[model samples]
Target: MTPHQAEQVSFDNTELDKFAAYRSDGATPDAPDILDLSNNELMLPPLPAVAESLHRSGLRVNLYPDPAARFLKANLARHFGAEPAETVVGPGSGGVLQQLLLVLAGRGDEVLYAWPGFDAYPLLVAVTGATGVPVPLTATGEHDLPELLGRVTSRTRAVILCSPHNPTGRRIPRDTLREFLAALPPRVAAIVDQAYMEFDEEEDPHDLGLIREYPNVVLLRTFSKAYGLAGLRVGYAFASAEIALRARKTVIPFSVTHSGEQAAVTSLAQGEELARRLAHVRRLRADLHADLGAQGLTPIPSSANFVWLPLGGESDRFAEAALRAGVLVRSYSGDGVRISVGTEEAHRRVLIAAKEFLSV
Candidate 1:
């Protein structure tokens, strides 16, 4: 084909417009007076030991990271009590999730997940050339398991379940999840998105026995939220050896940076420090929930480090009010607004704006 033909091919723009680009709160401009709680990022600095590890790793910028992130994989295997072959590491949970989808799904396949959950799910599934089938959450903002299972067909490649679900903040109880898994078809893989599992202080976050029970399960996790390593972007997953191997084959080489890998390794060693941060986040979440309730708003109780208000048509209005108060929060259009558990000043600002909005 001639160069002119190649340029003309780009003119079609058919597949290019299949979906919208993935947007994130990280794009919000940083300002001295602004408190951006739009993104569910830990507002605290990195832990002492984690900070030191990153500092040392920074000195070797001239070298390339381990393409497969062998050390990080080994550490994760030990931390989560799995064999190295059972692990898949990538730049972030989203990145790792994409890796899994690239292997498990493709053109003509359908991936099912809850709507008003992760904004990126459909976009991520689209990248694999698969259609994203959204199962709407219940009126109470919880997943309807039977409804989801009923949507599955012979072409269904995977079903994603997010516990401590995003934006809505409701978690799937272990027994409930186990029951769902039991009913799911054997050929279909179940990807359990556990990005916020660390903030779930009331349950056993370290449990890996679920994978043993369901070999098709893929537990996706990240160092972003509670570990304060969002900037570094280290994520991993635990799956059966066969599934993990396929996911690993899809990993983008060197996507996990050296500094990110080391920081994750160091963070894994500080269980006590991690616990302290988790407890602090839980306190902030509860306080924020109660405070919002006091303002006559119904904020869903969260197992994650954020509170979700199902404002219906007021979602955008409430988010606008928060921005006017110099606090940025996420608005899911007519669904709700998600306010990350930020510092005291941020929450204070949110409360004032909320009360002001209610009074009007």
Candidate 2:
């Protein structure tokens, strides 16, 4: 075998395959092309105000950005009711997560989290040379807080809690979260990844209140979803001032581009517009679930902007069928296909394709 082939064998082959496969082949209509639900990016672009700010910033090619991202952090803190020193902005929340893994984990350290959750947690922990301990979720696709708490050990450095979780789209309720945190070991860091919190229909979807009381809890938020700033890649984290400092050290200065920061800050000031967009997506997601049910495909209840269809290997078949009908959806084998709640047109296309797939 070639050296390159040997290197490829060292990683999770499933991830390698998923990463390598494109939803569509440019020249072929046989490949999926109509809808892209694979990467979880919001279908809409940022508001004109945000777009205008980026356009006016021009090229800051020669200057180093504010190393501490003070102004941007301050704006975010003010919006979230947190202190400026308690928050740190990163190019994207994913990048921030990478930094957290680097700083808090090392060889022989075990990182605890729930499985069928974010695909990145284990991958990131492994990259940092730490062991990953995944506590399985309940049958309803909810994180089992008791199981997770039981697995925490002296060697466990951190845990990642993904609410409005990926793939499954179920959320961990506030009362459940409080119980879990109360049970967690003080030394173990708990990272709350609220990537899809904006789309949550539930009241009080976040746990910012816990940050005020638990120095160990770090809350992660991003602009990629409801804010529609995915292209600019902006996100931030909030923790106790001391923990925030350690997390900040993992990322180098100017890592967050000036344009991205400006766009995010502008979006924050734009206010209720984002909440309006999320409400629309939430409504559409519910409508799509009913549509899928009408066609005999069970779509798991979702709190995020997408729905999960439980179909194992048939997920690949479902995705292929979707492509045949000129629509694309995200595939998860151990569970099913995840269709993004996009335009009304896209949602209708998925419904038609799903009906056709089920009939056959």
Candidate 3:
């Protein structure tokens, strides 16, 4: 094509036109008194030790971060009982996922995931020039694994499963996941996104030996959730050496900052603090679930830091009610509402909204 034709054609049908950009609660403005629980971020601040480490690392602004982020990879591998060669660190789990998608898929390839899952999945797949196939969630808000499997085709390059799934908060049982992986064609990669894994008490995230049986499995995680390091944007994954090597090649050079890396390393060592935070979050999550239940809203039992109300068409209405009551919540229109567990006061505000919503 001629230069003018190329420019016109590209402008007329931009790659971005195929998908919607991700929008998070953090990006929108909030009122001063609003108790924002829409983002599902940890309510607690960083551990004191982690903060101190980040402070010390901040002085190295002029120097670039380790392109390989070897320090973080080593610590993460040690903490999880994996080898450094199997670890892939990136700006965040999403970034790590991008790296994986870049290496694993491209035009004519299909990457499948549950619909109403992480909003970023489609955008990320589109960036890789791959088609994103979304399987609708069961009416009960859980993954329909059989349906997902049926959608797989020869062109399918990957399947992403988000445990303690976003929005719905439903976690796939370990045995069930193993079965799914076993049934999946080995040629297709299985990405298990455990971003909220730390918030779960039933499943041990350290079951790091999963990659042994399934060479195609990639266990992805992020420090942004339970670690309260959302701003730092540190995330990593454990995979076979072959997958890790290719994913690392796709990493944006020096994307992982020095401060972020050190904070992650320091955070891993703060077991006591981490445990305490988890306990507190679990308490808050339980209370929020109960309070919402008492208000006549059936909140699905959540394994993450948030609770989901499968309100269907009432979703937007519920979110608006929460906003009016000085609380922020995420509403997946025509689907449900996901409200993060927050301070008792923020939660109380949520309960008030729930009560009002129910009475209406």
Candidate 4:
């Protein structure tokens, strides 16, 4: 008898084919020497204490990390004024988001979020076997709360809101966000992705009032952007104990390494240093925005560590020009470009590119 043919592999081929890898701003193939402003990372080194923690943890690399990440969770809880049971830690905020999606959504359920927001939202939602629905941002790059509310249906399982939204750096006002949450159905979870929260100096980064008032609301934070811990891959979330527990269950064992936990905990203790870093970032962001404006390029008013240039069809061209000028920025094809705040020298190079590109 002829050997039976292998059965076709089971997979979501369509979704897998459509998926694009997350692109971060860094040394590009054409311009390895370019100053990287593609990723919205703090252009600074880690805190002295954090670095020391990393050094100390080097000797412990041979040991397995705490699978529950108890110490990191406790530190985050203490820093954010939440109970340890109400927090979850993971490899990064992106990882924590994946955990939440897996716990709260599944096949046939729908996850809604603003388009051109965090690039990972759709990918993460898709991995959970949920349908990803994207609503467009307003012309000014702010969330259209009414539009998002109108799109919610019975099948909608979760909504991801990004403050100081990525690629645009526009924040949803506190009152506006509160109203949006109030209008959302309690059954549908609201995930407030506050990855850039610390950069908004005007806001109390540790405030958990929203989660307290609305048990369905979850806050996502990361040490990647503000803490200069991108390489460490530490992120966390705060939610109602029920949701937090469920999400925690989805975490892969020991995904957060020992070094990340120690570094993050140490960084949390450097409140004054964090404040100084925030002030410097805010100042640099302002200078970059103003300088771009002087070059006749209208960048969106940013409340985060990056600025958005609504270059529309010219986005790619501008990015190319910046690359040629020795600076790397993130371009969204026909939409716009996001330039992270960098050193004065890097900003000068970007400005040179901006002036040349506009004059052409």
Each candidate's number of clashing pairs is 0, 0, 0, 1
Give the 10-residue window scoring lowest on summed lDDT in candidate 3. Answer: 7-16
TM-score of each: 0.96, 0.88, 0.96, 0.96
Each model's C-alpha lDDT? 0.90, 0.80, 0.90, 0.90
Stretches of candidate 2 exceeding 4 Å from the true structure: 1-33, 203-207
Q: Which pairs in model 4 have colliding backbones? A: 25-38
Look at candidate 1 and give me any clashing residue pairs.
none
| Alpha-carbon lDDT of model 2 | 0.80
TM-score of 3: 0.96
Q: Name the regions of candidate 3 deviating beyond 4 angstroms.
A: 1-15, 24-27
> Which ranges in model 1 have alpha carbons more than 4 Å from their true place?
1-16, 24-31
Best by TM-score: 4
Candidate 1 TM-score versus the reference: 0.96
lDDT of 2 by residue, 1-360 (tens): 988877764554332243322333322334445666666777877688887988876577467777777778998888888888888788788878877778888878899888777776777777777888888878777888888888888899999999888878998888888888888888999999988887886735344798887888988888888788787778899888988888889886787877887888889877677777777888888999998898888888999888988787688778877776677777766667888888788887787788777877
- Which candidate, 1 or 2, has the higher lDDT? 1
- Angstrom error of the Cα, residue 142, model 1: value is 0.7
Model 2 residue 50 lDDT? 84
lDDT of 1 by residue, 135-204 (tens): 9999888998999999999999999999889978889999999999999988899999999988886567
